[model samples]
Target: MSEPAVSVARYLATTTAEGPGLRTAIWVQGCSIRCAGCFNPHLFPTEGGVRWSPADLAARVLAEPSTGLTLLGGEPFEQAEALAEVARQVRAGGRSVLTFSGFTHAALRRAAAAGRPGVAGLLAATDLLIAGPFRRDRLDHERPWVGSTNQEFVVLDDRFPDLADWRPGALDRVQVDVDRAGTVSVNGWLDTDRLDALLADL
Candidate 1:
């Protein structure tokens, strides 16, 4: 039987920065919360990454000495079905899944409460969901898992159950910047078609 499937801009075999050891990372495509300024704007608009069956990704994670799937993106939450399917593969193979999203924990909860598109299934299978958008000004290199201080690493492991179910409101977006000759400048979210075109051309 094949493993499962996932949507992604690219799936790097391993990354040094995304959590625990020997992690297989999947960078998904697309984003909606285009803050005033954001980095990786290049990946903002793209969606439905290259098709790979669950067995495909799971095989890699299983073959490697890794413990799970570490997800990233333009926004993993947007591609809920793909993510859930990927998570199912990871869990089935006895591996864990760690996901990242732009929506804050509270915001995701609210969306799910209102029956938003992709919130429930995605969160249900995700082991760790790092929430909130990146803020250039609040960027903290010290933080291991997030880009800015406003973003938080939410640990969901049977503790504080129904975390994704409770919501009051949406969370705020943050700024992102690039330094040029000691000058700080902001770059907002990039259009998906443009980004994909550029990558495809390359």
Candidate 2:
């Protein structure tokens, strides 16, 4: 059977702000759990992004010289099967995969137990998973990548051994890039006040 097309909202070749090291990032399109105060509200609709087959997406990511791949919203698990294939291929090529999701780990486990193959596949392929919804009221100031204190960081396998030693209070880094046409794109975690200040000066 042919693989389903992956709706890609954004693709960055290399960025340190997304994960543990310089990594290729793919922001998927469409989100079922539209959390209040979500950062990428524009990505909530499924119809906006360009679609690519899993093989093609994996190839594009592998061509990059980054150390790993980071999968971000709309929600990786929503398009789990295709993204799982991409993650498997990336790992086969000797790179790690980090995935973010709005669903809690327990909920994901329940889905998997109910025979959701895609969810199982994606979970198996992911090396690190930042799970849980974005809670605006519970902003996380101490963690490295997560936005809320409710999110759980799960190290799925041995890929990121050093992650176990990772502690809170690590500073979050943001990246601002301007394309040739002067389109500015920003990623990473930042508080509302600081982000407003940064964007105001831009």
Candidate 3:
């Protein structure tokens, strides 16, 4: 039987802005939340993205020397099964996993407790989970790895012990990448006004 595939909108081989260290970032393609002022509005559509097998994607992520893997999306929880498999593979290779979700940790815990398919598996595979829907009004640029003040950083495992000592208010965040095709992409949090100015220039 063939391995399950994930709907991937895009992926960055390595990025420091997404997590604590250099990490591989995978952006899945679909979201039901549709939060206003979402940074990646293009990813909201359920359709339109390349389907990649978990094993293949894991291999690509592991090819580079990364401290961890960061999963974000349209919504990572929406495609939990495939991501869980990828997380499992990456963890087996000794890399930590960080995930971003639109759902709260409490909600995910409830889903896991109720025996929802993939929810428990994905949660188990994650070492850290940044949860909550993006609120444009609550946009926060001071905190690391979160888009808004309403979101939270939940530690699921002790792999990243130093995270406890990390302080907020770092301004040196965000990364801009221009692919060979000249398509520009931005990652990480930017306050509403700055983001608007950046977008206006683009």
Candidate 4:
């Protein structure tokens, strides 16, 4: 049997800002939620991202010296099966998995209970899940790991025990990365005004 293919918009082999430690971040390509104030609007389109098999993606993520894996959007649950496989492989290598989703945990629980394909597997493979739609009105600048106040950090496993007390302030919270193609990207939570200033300086 062959592994499912994942539509990948972008990926960073290593980054400290995505989670507790150095982590590999994989941003999937499509999102149906289309929240009003999405930071990565470019990823809304359901097409145009490069495709990678689960095995290949797992190898790429594990190739680097990362403490864990961070799954970002367009929406990780949108391609649950592929991401599940990737997470499985990463965890098998003794690394934890963190995932961001536009769907709430309750909704995901219902989906999993209803037997949605890949939902249970993905949740099972994840250690921590940041779940909720990004609400512009409820944007939270103080939270280090989430975009909005409504988002909840649901720890599915005990792998990331430190997150219970981890709190990152403005300094050293955001990470800026420029790929070989000269595409500059930012990750982590920041105040809207501060984010504007940071982008203006760039």
Candidate 5:
């Protein structure tokens, strides 16, 4: 059988913006619950994006010099199986996995209980999970990584020892990357007004 493929929208080798430590961030393509005013509407479509076999993807992510791996979206849960393998391999290499999802933790738990293929595996591989859909109206200025207050940050294991009592006091960081081709990309959390101003200044 052919190895499972993950539709990867974007990949950042190392960054401090996505999670607790310098991490490799993978943004998978396709989101079932496309929330209003989402940061990456371009990633909502299931089609497009570079496809990589689970083993290959895991190898690439592991090659990066980072302390952790962060799974962003187009909804990481949408491609749970392949990504679970990826996360598993990363974790085996002594790295942590942080996953962001539009689905509620309760919903995921139910799915896992129902014996969903990779839901339980993915959850198992994750050290930290940020769950819930984005609510534009519920803008969360206090939290560091999440856009809204409805999102819950759950620490799954003792891997993230420093985060045992983690709060939302830490300031969020956004990064802008300009490749040699002059194409620009932005990641991390930033409010509209400031983001607009920053992009305009760029």
Candidate 6:
């Protein structure tokens, strides 16, 4: 048989609260980490997402000027193949790629050491990387692209990994009013289990 077809779960194109500029955000699907307070447990159920082609994704991202691409959950790095292709397209088109992950930079490095494919390529082509997951205990309202203090918005360029823009943070966090009809229009990651429990309680 041919090699197993690599499939990646692609969520709807959404926006970010604190990143660079206008961005075409892709929320990928699937994760097994099961962090107790994961904001996006809905992503853990992979069956709900659609499969977007790398080229199609690239086209939508490029349609706007001064807009970069931001890769979000279920965890962008979980499927290296998906991210690497995204990186390649963005780089080739002279745009930047930003990604948020539940995995820490050190964790990704460790995975690469253990022969994880696509990490190097993805990192190499990426301009920014927001590493680590959101921590309920470390929540900080005044940071960039991060919910908790533990999460960092890292610029992965070889020359300036230690730099922090320290720019005035953008107002990207959002609140939603879910109706009884179950409309789910919101921003940032959602803690699915907690949400379900809350919904059930209501």
Which candidate, 5 or 6, has the higher lDDT? 5
Off by over 4 Å in 6: 1-18, 158-166, 169-171, 175-184, 189-202
Where is the poorest 10-residue window by lDDT in model 4?
A: 163-172
Give lDDT tens digits, candidate 2, residues 1-202: 8667789999999998887778999999999899998989999998899999999899999999998999998998999988899999999998989999999999999999998869999999998889999999999988888899999998898867644434753558899999899999999889889999999999
Question: What lDDT does each candidate get?
Answer: 0.64, 0.90, 0.86, 0.87, 0.90, 0.65
Candidate 5 lDDT by residue in tens digits, 1-202: 7767899999999988887778999999999898999999999999999999888888998899898899999999989989999999989989999999999999999999998879999999999999999999999988778999999998887877744334654678899999999998999999999999999999
Off by over 4 Å in 1: 1-5, 158-202
TM-score of 6: 0.75
Model 6 worst lDDT run, 10 consecutive residues = 2-11
Write the number of the candidate with greater TM-score, choosing between 2 and 6: 2
Give lDDT tens digits, candidate 4, residues 38-115: 988999988978999999999988898998999998999989988999999999998999999999999999999999
Model 2, residue pairs in steric clash: none
Candidate 1: give the clashing pairs.
Answer: 3-54, 3-55, 4-53, 4-54, 4-55, 5-54, 41-190, 45-192, 46-192, 136-175
- In TM-score terms, candidate 1 sits at 0.69
Clashes of each: 10, 0, 0, 0, 0, 5
RMSD of 5: 1.3
lDDT of 4: 0.87
TM-scores for every candidate against the unseen true structure: 0.69, 0.96, 0.91, 0.92, 0.96, 0.75
By lDDT, the better pick of 4 and 5 is 5
